[model samples]
Target chain A: MADDIKPRLRVPTTAKKGEVIEVKTLITHPMENGQRKDAAGNVISRQIVNALKVTYNDKPVVNVKLDTAVAANPFMSFFVKVEESGTLKFTWTDDDKNSWTAESKIEVA
Target chain B: MNTLLTRRTALAAIASVIATRSALATPEQAKEWLAAQAKGTPTEGKITLKAPEIAENGNAVPITVSVESEMTEKSYVKAIYIAADGNPNPPVATYEFTPLAGKAEVQLRVRLAQTEKLIVVAEMNDGTLYTASREIKVTIGGCGG
Candidate 1:
């Protein structure tokens, strides 16, 4: 498993019913593209967070496929409509099959 | 005077074509990439891509893509693709959306190696594709910087 992998999310604590809100996410990752060499001139193994999926209230909101070109600490911001109070789930999967998840809740008033 | 004006207009048209061809990915390359991703034929329009014209740091260049859509059960943006012409891996990211998602807009940060044209293609639920592109200049390298 990757070390020190952490998922971060920014979501509003409250929202109006049926309102569109912005959500931002970030994850700490090295995102090794397999093109780098060490001091001894050996190619580092490729390890990247290749996919990210987000769900709101158990319904899919967004699914992202990332490539080697993505930089370290992947960050994404997107919009979602809130119909009721629920939790937003975020999952990030890497090339090594390691995955991390985080969740946030919002209240609709 | 009329003949001179016509000749100048023709010259301008040819110059513009050359400029675009040099800056953008070859049609064949774009087609092959799109086809590999299983995206059907993409027509140009409806996709709006916003990125910095000049990025001081290539490590985290912000980008946003929005598609015209009505986010209904019958109609919505199915997916959105972001690609770079000069990156080692041209395809940067793909965002898939459903009607339940409500909107067809996304913003993310990407690493660009150098000055290159960024392409955004949005696939509609109806299987139609809309595309847009922009050029971004990077002064610092993402990997090393």
Candidate 2:
């Protein structure tokens, strides 16, 4: 199993009401595609994060379903419209059913 | 007529193989995938796919998929699927969006086994479909190798 998993985000802490902001996220993972062979020529099993879900103030914003073709240390960026001050939560799930969560707060004036 | 078309395609394939000096994925499988993934006949507008014309590295090719929409509760982009024809498995990702997303745009990185075509199909809240694609040339394969 891959270790040292980490999640990173770049979100503006403040925004005007009804403003559209970009949310950039990056997670550390090997994203093993199961296509590689070790020194012994044995096939490596695939291990990858399969999904990412984002919710704003408990309302769903977006959910991305990942596949083996996604590169390692998956990175994504998307836009969100903030109307109020609330928390934006992110969840990433892997093939092993392991999940990591992160959150960012954006204050809207 | 069919035979003539087949021969012409075969000739083109040979020419392409010689130019690249490697085997590549034909557009057939990718076209079939696009057709199958779409809920219905997808139109040619409302969506845009951006990628480098020539990706220096295939392991991490950046791409952006954008769909035109007002992003309201009644009308918005519901889902988007991306696939690369040259990969062992074409599917790259599927993104689902709600009105809260405000804009139906996403940037992602994908692995491409070789030079191939990337296709994207989007489904809207109203059940309409939009499609777009791009051809990316890869200098090195991104698969396990």
Best by lDDT: 2
Among all windows of 10 consecutive residues in model 2 chain B, the one with the lowest summed lDDT is B20-29
DockQ of 2: 0.77
TM-score of each: 0.84, 0.88
Kindly give the stretch of ten consecutive residues in candidate 1 chain B with the minimal lDDT sum: B21-30
Cα-based lDDT at residue A44, candidate 1? 88
- Give fnat, all candidates: 0.68, 0.87
Quote model 2's TM-score: 0.88
True contacts kept of 2: 0.87
Error of 1 at B63 (Å): 0.9
Q: Which stretch of 10 consecutive residues in model 1 chain A shows the poorest summed lDDT?
A: A1-10
Docking class of 1: acceptable
lDDT of 1 by residue, B4-51 (tens): 999999999999966754554343454457667645777889888888
Question: Model 2 off-target regions past 4 Å?
Answer: B1-33
Interface RMSD for each of the candidates: 1.9, 0.7
The digit string of per-residue lDDT tens for model 2 on B8-124 reads 999999998666534445466666766676668888888889899999889999999999889998898999988888777778898999999999999999999888889899999
Candidate 1: list runs displaced more than 4 Å: B1-31, B143-145
**lDDT for each candidate structure:** 0.83, 0.90
